[model samples]
Target: MASPLITLRENTIWENKHGTVSITPRSLCDVWNTWVGPGVSNGPIWRPGLAGLRALVAQAEAQNQRIRGLGGAWSLSPAAATHGIMVNTKPLNYIELGFRDASLDTAFSGNPDALCFAQCGASVLELYQYLEVRGYTLPTSGASNGQTIAGAVSTGTHGSAHSIGSMQDYILGLHMVIDGGRHCWIERASKPVVSPSFCQAIGAELLRDDALFNAAVVSFGSFGLMHAVLFEAEPLFLLEKSLVRMDYARVQAALGTLDVEALDLSGGRELPFHFEVVVNPYRVSRGQRGAYVRYMYKRPYRPTQASAGGSTWVQGDDVMTMLGTVTGWTPHLVPVLLEPILSAQLAPVQGVAGTPGFQFGAADLRGYVMSSEIGVALADAPNAIDAVIDVANRFHWSGFPAIRYVKGSDATLAFTNFSPTACTIELPSAGSPRTLEAFHRVWDELRARGIRFTMHWGQMMRENREWIEYGHGARVEEWLAARQSLLGATGQRAFGSDWLTACGLG
Candidate 1:
């Protein structure tokens, strides 16, 4: 079979918002042939199908070369970098729907209409459109729609859905090309979905293990390159969104207990589908100040003659761009300058109703942006927020903080691993040394206070061996054991990178 046309650029300078890399892909292969390369070859390859991906992994293992997959390049961290071959999975995108048959096992009793197989490179926006047309919708998604399905789940990207968990929670199955040319489809043994025949048709060995499945869901490319994912989607629905300004006390009440009814929201006693609070640390010091809050409720889908609102399609300007304009104007005056900017950015308490696809549309990438996020137990949200505000005030930092909640995820390494509910506190700011220092201080203070927290895998974090050990504890050992079981010592060495090594995962 003919190979896909592959392109290679040598000594290329890859720069994202946070870091820069002088990547050197010694040799490049753009082909979909599983057996294209001979044993002991160091050539880089771009595989467009499952067979080709497996072949490339086998070749990398044979040649003792490290490999990594790149998708969208939206991550601020360097987890995707490799010292050897880099496989660009952008061209391998493919999507399909699952079907039901009598041959299926009785354990496979899920709604067949809700099953979807999305290839590694398929972006979230693309999947949204595809599912929307079929009267299906993703249960939850990140604020931005540009991230690929595999990348989003692998890095534990999440939304502010108080009920729904992170993206990894909805994943029913994972199709992966592991080291030594092994291809397998993994799912929970307790709740098996796909039949053996379906796995065989896709040329995969079936493995129904709960721990292995949970570990691989958020492996961050360490469990080998994921070829595709099987997602369980929900029926299409509308979201009624309202953005309002509330007093700090009211916002604190909601964050403290997550009891929306206590706050006297419009939908009394009914939990909101999505809730978020954006706060200005400087303003929080004033007893009378308020924060911007957004609430979204799920509604049954209905046909309407009216077109979607303009605001729904256009996601306004990037917050990073707005903050960048005032950079270097005056560090101390940042709070004052940001007040009006934030108001303008989050103004007009208008109501909007639309499908999830239109509501959380594509994200616009702007100049350098860096963010740090940590997940803490919901009961500790009040103290955590206060500590963060203290750190911001003490350092006079220009960045602002926001809090979003999500149900705890089952993924072993997910930052939202806190049981019951977890609140993710995010600090996004213009990339600067001062901002980085402030971020580090926040972590240091939280650690000193004995506050147990986990950092987002895809965001900028002050991660070290001790931090990982302290945050994850026994789960860290379980994840490492699962990794060892899936990818043996040689495979781990071939797929691991410096970031993984620094965190003691490699």
Candidate 2:
């Protein structure tokens, strides 16, 4: 890795509407991405990869003894940073859309339980497009799919649904570079340890402890380098997504009973395949639904000319769109810039009713542009929402909306990681400093009140110093103890990163 200001310019994020946004690097050392995790210089920075990355890390290990790999810049927290060598694995992006067995059976075949061998840098959107080709889908996903599979699972990226778990829940196994970079494969504990031959086939020494394995599955970047992930996906089906404005009063009445009881607008109600609740701070006086809620119903796949018909392009676009939204322009303006364009993207929106593979909440991935600055999660859905409204009433920062909804998650870092016991209360906005200040005031008030809510590892929520203390709290200790136990010494140092220190996770 070299050092040169001019070379570093390549890694900067291109804020302009048209032009390349690449990481600036004088040499390999400066290479990084759009993500800024702990101690990282603000903005995009390119990182050298392949031998260059390993060489840097090796040198660090010989000296400072700390180096870590970073997946997607999806994390708003510092979990991806490192004082030593930081390998930007984002370029390792690739999705091998194939299967292994839903039963964890090595022999079975035939789209066996919709599965994919996702690389360390493969984005969720990319994985989705790969699955679409084969007519398969994952059980769930986060609001958007910009995060890499490795980052999403490691950080416990969550979607709205409690019945299922976080990104880790669907992850059936892992392929990682271990001590001295020994590639290892981990799966749900097996009866006989995957057989010596099979273990060698995938290049790993098998381990079978439920506690350690589970903890490490969602271990964030603190775990060793993740090269690939084996996730269990669902059958290919269409998700009939529909958005409706919700009534604040009715929502208040149905808050507790809503998600838990199901029975949305489709009669006495039942949970849709997917759900989303968007709160508008400016809507207090407006007569729109309390919050815009969307529901998705599952259906069999059927392709047409209008549909991409099992193409990778859909997911590819979704990835770029996810990244673009973070810049804070209305996603609704997609037609203005991208509607007529044809290019590679994971999740596609080409004015088609539905694609052959499937669909989920907020089908219009393009219409949801949002800024990356504000991210906050309030614990106890009902309590969090009330507190938000109360604060808004007091400060008149009602223009910003507090999005609500539930998603299934079991990731150690997911805000709603615990079921029944967890529900997310997020505050999202594309606004001015005054409105943002109002948000902070309320967030601080709730923190003082001791409301536990896990913040999204990606998106906003990265600035809260006491985030883990308030969100993970007791569970944090349990996970830390469990993680320490799982990633024992000899290899623990390699797994440790600045990300942990930033979140007070070490």
Q: Best-fitting candidate, measured by lDDT?
A: 1
Per-residue C-alpha lDDT of model 1 across residues 227-338, encoded as one tens digit per residue? 8899878988988877777667767877878877766567776778988888878786446455877778898987632212222324322344455555546545565676
Error (Å) of candidate 2 at residue 498 is: 4.1
Q: What is the lDDT of candidate 1?
A: 0.76
Candidate 2 structure, TM-score to reference: 0.72
Error of 1 at 291 (Å): 1.2
Give one digit per residue, the lDDT tens place, for model 2 in 1-506.
24212112223332211111123222223332233334434321222222233344345545646656666555544556554445666666656554433334554333444556666777766666677667666777776555677887776665655566567777767766655555566765532223446555554677655655666777776667776677656666665555555556555544544542432465236665555455554344446444555455555776643232233333432322443443345433332333122122222222234542334222233322333222233235566667677776676632333343444444555555555434555544323454457656766766776665556654444444476667566667767776675555645676575556656666
CA shift of 61, model 1, Å: 2.0
How much is 30 displaced in model 1, in angstroms? Answer: 6.6
Instruction: Give the Å shift of residue 340 in candidate 2.
Output: 25
Q: Which pairs of residues clash in candidate 1, taking residues 3 or more apart in a chain or in different chains?
A: none
Give the TM-scores of the predictions, in the order they appear: 0.91, 0.72
The top-ranked prediction according to TM-score is 1
How displaced is residue 79 in candidate 1, in Å? 1.4
